[model samples]
Target: MLNILRSHRISRFAVIGGASTLVYAVCALALSRGGTGAAMLPATAASVVAYAIAGLFSYAGHKYFTFMSAGAHAFELPRFALLNAMGLATAIALPVVLTERLGMPAAIPIVLTCIVVPLVNYIVLRRWVFRDV
Candidate 1:
């Protein structure tokens, strides 16, 4: 447990993730103020923007710190973009469906979906997208 927590790569990834979440939350809040009905598009757009910005940092951090890929390869950018797109879709769709379609609180579905998706994202990214080993 301690060894896993102490991993330099994981630590850096956590930092990047935390920052991205902060960005998302701020954007969501600002958008949500315009009434719930009006908030959806702006919030979604903001989330996508935040994901892109955060993903850029995440890819660099994972390459250098977590998985320790020395430099970019021909396939790296496209593969990374693809993985990020999948993660972004999951992140966006789950929250929207749970909150809007199901009439649940935004926070509940957002939190629950976030918890679920990260596990999947990590597995996909580690094994398929950024396999350093």
Candidate 2:
């Protein structure tokens, strides 16, 4: 347990993931609420936009910091983007299926999306996207 707690990659992931999640959650909530001068967006729309914004940060952080991989960007970048596209799909679909179809609140879908994306992403990033690490 202590060894697990001391893992360098996990430590880096926690820092990077926290920052990226903050970006995602803030954008999502703001867009959903139409904060400032922005027009209100549906939960699904907000999520897609948020995921796109966050994906960039996540990619750079995971590639350079968390995984510390020396793999060619040409190979890794498309794989990273593809994985994030999968994450974005989850971010979009959770709101549609949970809030629209099941009558749950927008908040629930957003929170669930936040939880699911990172867990799945970490596994895939290790196994495929940043496999060289």
Candidate 3:
């Protein structure tokens, strides 16, 4: 068990994932808060921006550290963008829809989204985006 944990690329992916989540949180907070007394952006818009910023870090980290891909980034980046788009849609759209339509607390859906998005992203990244060349 310990050997599997130490040897698996999933461990590396999880590390990069933690970093990416941190990036998203920082960017989202900054954008949504909008600095001392300035008008804040819509929450959905702020979250989308944050996801995009984290996507860049995700691509670089997975390419270099997680999957160790040496493929041309010209090919990889587009695929990575597509993956991130799906995740962004899930993260932003679900929370807004659940809050607006079903009357659930926005935080509930956002927290759920955070869990689901990473699991899906890990599968997609391992099988598709960062697959061995």
Candidate 4:
């Protein structure tokens, strides 16, 4: 089973990425919608919070499930953190730019960010973060 999964690395990453993206979207929607009637928080702020919360799950899932990285935390964690920081920035900034700046629908940027981040993350994780594995 492990060997089969190891052989299907991209499939495993898609599964984990789907799960983490779901987590992030749910949290972002809840936080963005659950506030005062007229004075709701901006989607960017909500996205940041959501990404931070979901990021914990993402790191674990990618390390153990997607990449199966047994690398040292002292090394990998910082790299993962950097990558996640880049992801978070994209997740937050896209929504803000698309929705607030461009007058697009909120969902547009949310969906775009979700799609774009996973692709970039997969490449980075495969080529850099989990390369030693």
- Highest lDDT against the true fold, candidate: 2
How does each model score on TM-score?
0.69, 0.87, 0.80, 0.86
Order the numbered candidates by lDDT, best leading. Answer: 2, 4, 3, 1
Output the better candidate (2/4) by TM-score.
2
How large an RMSD does model 2 have?
Answer: 3.1
- C-alpha local distance difference test of each model: 0.62, 0.84, 0.76, 0.84
Worst 10 residues of 4 by lDDT: 32-41
Candidate maximizing TM-score: 2
Clashes of each: 0, 0, 0, 0
Model 1 accuracy (lDDT, Cα): 0.62
Model 4 scores a C-alpha lDDT of 0.84
Q: How well is each residue in 73-97 modelled by candidate 1, as lDDT tens digits?
A: 5666678788778878865885567
lDDT for model 2 comes to 0.84
Candidate 1 residue 126 C-alpha distance from true site, Å: 2.2
For residue 88, give model 2's deviation from the true position in Å: 0.9
**Which residues of candidate 4, in runs, are more than 4 Å off?**
1-7, 34-40
In candidate 2, residue 70 scores what lDDT? 92
Q: At residue 111, what lDDT does model 2 achieve?
A: 83
